[model samples]
Target chain A: MRDASRAASGRKVCLLTGAAGILGATFCRRWRHEYDICAVYRGGRLQVPTQEEWFIDPLSPHAALRENDNPVFAVKSNLREPAEVQRVVDLALARFGRIDLVVNAAVHVDRDRLTSLASSSDLLDETFAVNATLPIQLAAIVCRQFWQHSRQDNQAWGRNVINLSSMASLGVVAGVGLSAYSASKAALNMLTAHLAAELAPIGVRANVLAPTSFPQLVPTSLVADTVVDLDRSDLTGCIVQLDENGLRETPSAPSALHF
Target chain B: MTMPEPRTLQAVNDLQPLLQARRWRWRATPFPHIVAENVFVPDVQEELARDFRTLYDQRTTAGYNTQHDFLGTSLISTQCGSLEVFISPAWYALFTRLFGINEPGFLTAGVHRHRPGSRNGFPHNDIFPERLDVGPGRGDVLRFGGPVAGKSVRAVAILYYLNNGPWAPGDGGETSLYWDWKDGVDTPVDSVPPRDNTLFAFSCNPHSYHSFRTNRKRRDSVISFVYRGVDDYVQLWGDEGLRQYAEYGRHHA
Candidate 1:
């Protein structure tokens, strides 16, 4: 049994997108002990509830762990709107006082049957906007407003932005119907790489986690643990892939173009 | 001109814990300065912002340069009386404690309204060679009296931003800090936007070069300077080097 109020102050705060999704909820439930999660969702409701009911059995081995306290803050905001994005960041900062990590787990998959025929320009645009553009926008506002001038000395506060990517982005999944989805996720990967390169000097990390498939080959808990590991490691500008063989990393190539 | 609302003693007392809890960590690079975010609590922040908007809408006059206009008030404007009476001593004590100054000091404060699209201003450090007609008492302001002997040295400068609305990226009113005036206005070591209820302050030195960036919208802030007497000035940079530094600032300004 953990005390929620007491533990919240010492725990790092994570602003997680896609809280209603499987991976996002799992991450929240699993790491709610280590972090106070600001769970963000657009459509569906976040499934994790507070510690109201407890399943205690005297005969069970894990009976001592029956009592629980959840430290998840749920917020509904459409990331497509820049104003909504700013509001979400502001609310999180107001509640938690600081956000040490950002998890971009929100995804958009085009459902139009005509997407395979390359006829859905609007669908592609919306998908790209949500997946690629929104992440950068959120990153920019949070970095500028929340981080401020305090991180100037390159102090490793473990401040990071982690994007959940699909293996389809890496061309491992082949389907004409998934073209828009794959392209947008790939753009996110590259954008994360660029963001990582730019923010490295300031001691802020950005990386991507490319899973072969959620809950299919990779268990959701493994993916969550991998996020924690990636955040803890010194690695930046690398794509860590999860598959049957376990995690493998591919470092991003250095860019020749300088601003 | 419509008058601004005054900040009450109750407001200052309400903000005491927040200000006390804030760690005034001074950074040394570019220049010695401290940046404090969320400087006031929500209600006080809102009230101060409203007062600034009232003053800007009614009282501001034509600017000295094309870059910014002025609202030349006393050491503290009667409109925002609590800023000097109740709030400024907090800052004065903090700066003096940080610098370990044991002697007496004074402050000069005014409101500045930078016009939108007015981007062409030279970088300057506010260390003029002229003597401050005001004496060594707290809250004394420069009255610009007839020729006096010694220089009035500025020890610290603080800018409290009081914008009420949201400040977007493209609607840029940023206080650009530079490593040196030779670096030009384009290359700033750091650019602090005029965010609502934020405070940016720096020690006054020869290398403390700063200027405004292109503001797509109007920029408003309360600018205040903490000063020490001529003895401290002569000790820092002898009487001889005063004119040289002043000339350098004048040439750039």
Candidate 2:
């Protein structure tokens, strides 16, 4: 539940999962002023910097906005369950009355190899549930709300859903046991494309930003910038790959079971 | 060592008049360019398309800068047997006669593939005469003595589309010719779609400002550069350009 005593603000609301992760934390610290964030984390609490600790440094390209107190509303929830994902979406709406962006940054990377595939079935199932299913459920929930609200409001702004993915979804990562992780991310990429195509008529856009390099090697700010760029632009159904050079669009590989 | 069939050469020869007729100046500029459709016979077009597909599949490396994202490879890499069809002495003689140049000075020849969401190249002329330097250890520099004296040799570029069929309107990946830059805007004068077997040729000059953008579908083409006086051309963009091209050539080699 939101603290009703905090004044209802007119800023756009962003429901960001994995708020405790490195990329998510950087986004929260940088975009707090531009968005009223509903920060959702699964395991641990996110330690956001206070105003005294947060100096007036430029956070992003849209960093000119003045910072406000307690722009982020942290919610603790287990994303594996469908009910908990719904709660995160409901909490954002209750807190800000509108959800403009959904950043599905949470991921479950359990190492498993093809040789031990049968032994790792449980972990594979859990990985898919957390990484792929949760994102789709959250998108459905938010899109439903946006559709209902737009019927009454004539000037509804465009809503955006950004799914953070990895390059392993497109190509094999050498020497890494990522069978489950790769499958989950590949499915997530497809979900993003499907959502973009279906939701475009309703003014909702979806895209996947998969970094070609390791997450730690690529700057978090670049990821943040890509998210902002995708949000602001009218591009949909794009699978953009971030590398050392910059962002480039990659083709979605075909599924094995083609009917 | 396979060559284009005699019928293919005849068909291409038959389109010379149409290509010459399509030549026009953009926005009163003296830049000469021609876009001809159905330049090659169906069999040759199919062969080129197959070669490009094989190259695209075997492409292990690609590079991107601010200007464009390109998959650079050669016939040597793909090991396609149709190399002689594109670089035959007869074809060189035909181009020399068609363009009425003194000699066919082949500069660079390779396959270019741009997949969906690739960046559009910026508007710029291909020739940079002022940047050319014939210093020690540098590659051979060709000197022009006639009307183009003191100026570095200008080249003519040919783009042969290897797409299997006609492209839809606004499908992008079309080579765009610009008239001039106005208020930081690239004013497009004409655009040639990547139609099957279509060929676009133009002289690389100061007035030759052109760009290309890839659409959602893949774009494949064979692009070759030919200079008038120079036997070979080397684009020297200071040390950085040299280093980048050396690395690029090494990777694609």
Q: What is the lDDT of residue A41 in candidate 1?
A: 85
Estimate, for each residue in A123-233, the C-alpha lDDT of model 2 and write its tens digit. 778888888888878988887865544622312454668899888898777776788888899999998888777666566667888986545678887787777776665
TM-score of each: 0.50, 0.43
| Worst-scoring 10-residue span by lDDT in model 2 chain A | A52-61
DockQ (C-alpha) of model 2? 0.00
Candidate 1 clashing pairs, residues 3+ apart or interchain: B63-B69
Write down the TM-score for model 2.
Answer: 0.43
Candidate 1 stretches with Cα past 4 Å from truth are A1-169, A172-259, B1-25, B57-72, B75-79, B85-87, B135-149, B237-247
Q: What DockQ do you compute for every candidate structure?
A: 0.01, 0.00
State the lDDT at B98 in candidate 2. 46
Q: For residues B1-253, write the lDDT of model 1, one tens digit per residue.
A: 1212323222323335434224333344567665666766666666666766666566555235532333344435345533443235555555555555555666677767776766655577766654666545634363323123456677778888886368987787788887776678877766777887777887777777787787788787877777777677678756644554566655755
Q: Chain B alone, TM-score of each model?
A: 0.78, 0.66
